[model samples]
Target: MTTAKTPAAASPDTPQPHPRRWAGLAVLSASLLLVVMDMTVLNVALPQLSADLRPDSVQLLWMVDIYALVVSGLLVTASALADRFGRRLVLLLGFTVFGLASLAVLWANSPAEVIAVRAALGVGGAMIMPSTLSMIRHLFTDPRERATALGIWATMAAFGGALGPIVGGALLEAFSWHAAFLVNVPVMLLAIVAGLFLLPETRNPRPGRWDLPGTVLSIVGMVALVYAIKHFGKDGPTDPQTWVPALVAAVTLSWFARRNLRRPDPMLELRLFRGPAFTAGVVTALAVSIALAATMLLLTQWMQLVQGYGPLETGLRTLPEAVGAAIASPLAPALAHRIGARTVLAGGLALSGLGLLVIWSWPGTLDYWAVAIALGMVGVGLGSLAIASAVIMAGAPPEKSGSAAAIEETSYEIGGALGVAVLGSVAAAFYRTHLTSEELAAEGVTGRAAHVAQESIGGAMDLAHEMGGAGARLAAQAREAFTGSLEWTSVAGGLLMLAAALLVWRLTPKDLDLNEVEH
Candidate 1:
């Protein structure tokens, strides 16, 4: 009887690292830092931009979310293009676009104009995200080296998260909100220059014909699905406005799946999901993102609104999470070797869930130390998923690494968006539930004023400034209500994370060893 060959046996030397792989990693990690920083940097700029541009609520929301939506939607197509043309070429092209788009912010005086610039940035981001991972695959052919490289890459991402608020805050202090966008210019220029020298051009030698129909379906379905999820979370699931896109997404994605299954050369290799390790890795990527994004949102609001810290203080305080993540990133892979990837992955998620539960069960008093410790736990938990990303790329063939990267990036982007929409809705609901808005009426605050106070803690605080003595009562009530919302939301987030941990544990293969997988 004939047997299939193992990957290492078939190509024993394929896992060796390239001569300049470390140099290449420096370039790739810097590029990754740039992309991820841009993702978070804009959050600080939003209030200032809103004031200057005078965007209404809807436009403001779009300005905040559209980049992610567009990035998630286009990842698959961009990855496919990278596989066809050249990963390095697509990467450089993305840098050029990203740099020029950053420069475009100079003229962004209106909401519509800023939205257009953000859309361009999104396109560039989609190209850059997947290419970086696939290039890592090309640079570090050995499984152990690749794992270490991914650890460093994960560290860079954590560093970027830490840097975004601090960097943005300092820039906003010294200059206008435009400084946030303009900051990308010099970084991209450096990346583009270094990348051209250090990065190798790699592509799939036997790439299939670009499936245009599959491309369209993937983009449309993803965009529609995210849109439906966002609207459903915000407007309630019963809203008919969400139904159309949800239905379209289901139909189109279903059709797309059927076509891929029938095709000899599909855009996405669905068969990869059959591997328990890949499935587990993908799920880990998705679930961790949801948990991380939602909990971070909660902490940010609590620090600024409840603890009364300025943006700079809040940003600095958030550094513990990054420190924890940086410390844990390399440790996770080492731990995985001693225990197992399954144990480490599930354990990390469970620890994070426990941390969230701590916040949920906290008494009414705000404890900064407890919050910081909890964030550290979440960071360590999230740090373990660096191995998950390694598993994702390791399972795929060298040529199809781009496709795997695309899927991983898509999971992360969509997971973050889902986290915000779902957890934000839960928090908002609890905020409304806890607030006794009618009490404001007894304080001679009725009609428009009462309604405004009931809308948000911010609204209530603003109304309090005008109402003098009644404002203090209203502000106090709003803070209490908002705190209650945080508690309940943390409970929900913790439970979801626990369930995700269980699911990932169940999905992960018993014999799986990251160090032995692809190499």
Candidate 2:
């Protein structure tokens, strides 16, 4: 049995520590920080962006979402390309592309233009995300040292996610939504300069012939599935718009899985799922992302609109999650040792569910103190999943580290895409249910104004500010409707996290031990 490896170094005596491995790790962590931060900064940027761009609900969702969907489509192919060509070369090129794309946001005046910028950034992100993990696997060869390095990597990720909204909020306070993206430019430039100096060139010497068909299938199937999910959520299950792409996705993904299973040098190495621990890790990644992404997307808007907070204030309110994750990340290994890995793994999700339940319990108020408690609980829960990386990487053969990284990254990306599409749609649905066209018409706000008001809280608020007493009443009603929607959405997410916790508990071996994870 193999243990999943993470970003770490190899046996110092055998591989002589790669001399600059620690410095290389710093570069990797910095690059990872930017990628992860970019994923989240948009949460705080969305409302202002919506106000300026005036995107309808669907276009707004696409602008907020398509980044992850694009990343998901490209991750596997990018990982393979990195392995075949050169990891260092691919990573540096990723930095360049990422920087230039962020810079392009200067001219992204229209909704479609912004979405295109995000998609281009996703291309750069896919190239960076997996290559860093692959490099870390090669860097860290020793188990004990690898464990320590993993902690640092996980902490960096948590910290980056924590910083994103805050950093974006601070920038948005002074400037427009473009600053959220523009911030990435200098960071990527620095990464490129530092990477060129500190990082070592590495690649899989035996990368087989490029699996063009598999690559096409994976990318198209993933994009189709995500599109279907968003449409299914928005249009319901009966719509041909929803079902047609879904059918295509089902067939293409099934065929893709079959091809990977049959080929000795498969594009994805589907056999990784054969490891129970790997399966659990992948599932955790998916479920946690679904829960977290939706929570962040909704809560940020709620804070700004309902709570009457500025972006900076809203960002600060989210800090507790990071604090909780930081505290829990260090304690998770010890907890796993005392009880069991399975217990810690399942407990994390359960705790996060409890967080959602905590807020759901007081749905009428949506109090900050209660929300803070929930945030902390979810953060602690997030910390436990760091073990997931160890379990996944340790389970794969050394030669297949690149595949393992790709799979792990793919899970995170797709999970994020699904989270936004499915859960965001749920919130939108409930909001529309509470505030229908009839309700808006009753307020004497009809036509394009009523359509805009009913579509989203951001749009409604903007419309309200323009009108008089009627608009004030409309705004109040919109806030209440959105409150109800958030309540329902959070409970739905809570139940899902709870169900996933139970599933993880059952699927992982009862006697699973963390000590077994040392590669």
Cα-based lDDT at residue 242, candidate 1:
79
Measured with C-alpha atoms, the lDDT of residue 143 in candidate 1 is 68
**Cα lDDT tens digits for candidate 2, 1-519:** 113333244434435445677788889988898888888898898878877998867787688668777887888888888888998999899999999999999999999999999999989998998888888777766654454455557666777787788888999999999999999999999999999998888888888888999999999988888778777766788899789989989998999999989988888878988888778878887888887777778888899999999989988999998888888876666677688778988999999888888877974577789889988988888887667676667677656777888998888877776776688788888898888889888888889888788778987888888886658888998999888777777888889999999988887887766554544
**Candidate 1: lDDT of 236?**
80
- After superposition, the stretches of candidate 2 with alpha carbons farther than 4 Å from their true spots are 1-16, 511-519
lDDT values for all models: 0.80, 0.82
**lDDT score, residue 237, model 1?**
82
TM-score of each: 0.94, 0.93
Clashes of each: 1, 18
Expressed as tens digits, the lDDT of each residue in 348-453 for candidate 1 is 7888788788887766675788787777887777777668877788779888898789888999988888887898788888887767656777677888877767
